[model samples]
Target: MVERVTATEETLQLLDKLKTIHGELMFHQSGGCCDGSSPMCYPRGEFRVGDSDIYLGDIGDTPFYMSKDQYEYWKHTQLIIDVVDGRGGMFSVEGPEGKRFLTRSRVFTEEERRELSIS
Candidate 1:
């Protein structure tokens, strides 16, 4: 099955470490106006998600969401959650760990699109 979101081994390790400290976590990526378009992580319910957000799938056992508008632009690609040595969004849980969560993407092929039921 095709996944809308996924995390690298490195990213999953970081998430597991964060989970030990923060418990369950959630992720949200809003329009560019929020955190310079970087994805932000918060305790499951710390950040309220409502009609404006769309669940993109889970990465590292964490739910991931994006503003409806943001999803429109990203729908054709797979969101690859990665980690790098740097500061993340000021409010993201990983920011303090001296590492950052980065987003990488790849456009889906026609076969993949069909499997994902994404036209």
Candidate 2:
């Protein structure tokens, strides 16, 4: 009986993009500090998807559902939503468009490497 939670305009747009690429997405928080702390579209086991949850959308043309914990996390989010694309690429969200979910992970960005000077 689980249904997809309320999706904002921006969230829907992002979802559409993933659908086009036939990608899989996961949302998660590294449990860090800073506004919009959680990262979205995380590429790996960031959120831990399972087969027990009721999937609602298509990831890579495959529908997926969330675990109980995942649903809870989305229910209480305040800043952003974590997402992992079908291709296993991780990403985070921000701004008024995606400010409904609370972020938990440390902020992730392509710029992170530049800050850390990591290749």
Model 2, residue 91: distance off in Å is 6.5
Please provide, for model 1 over 22-94, each residue's C-alpha lDDT reduced to its tens digit, 9 standing for 90 to 100: 9999999865532224688898999999998999899888999998888878888888888889897788999
TM-score of each: 0.92, 0.33
Clash totals for all models, in order? 0, 36
lDDT of 2 by residue, 1-119 (tens): 22232344555566666545545554443344444433344433445655545343443332334445444444322233343223221243222233333333333344543553434
State the displacement of the C-alpha of residue 30, model 2, in Å, after optimal TM-score superposition.
2.0
Best by lDDT: 1
The list of candidate 1 runs beyond 4 A from truth reads 32-37
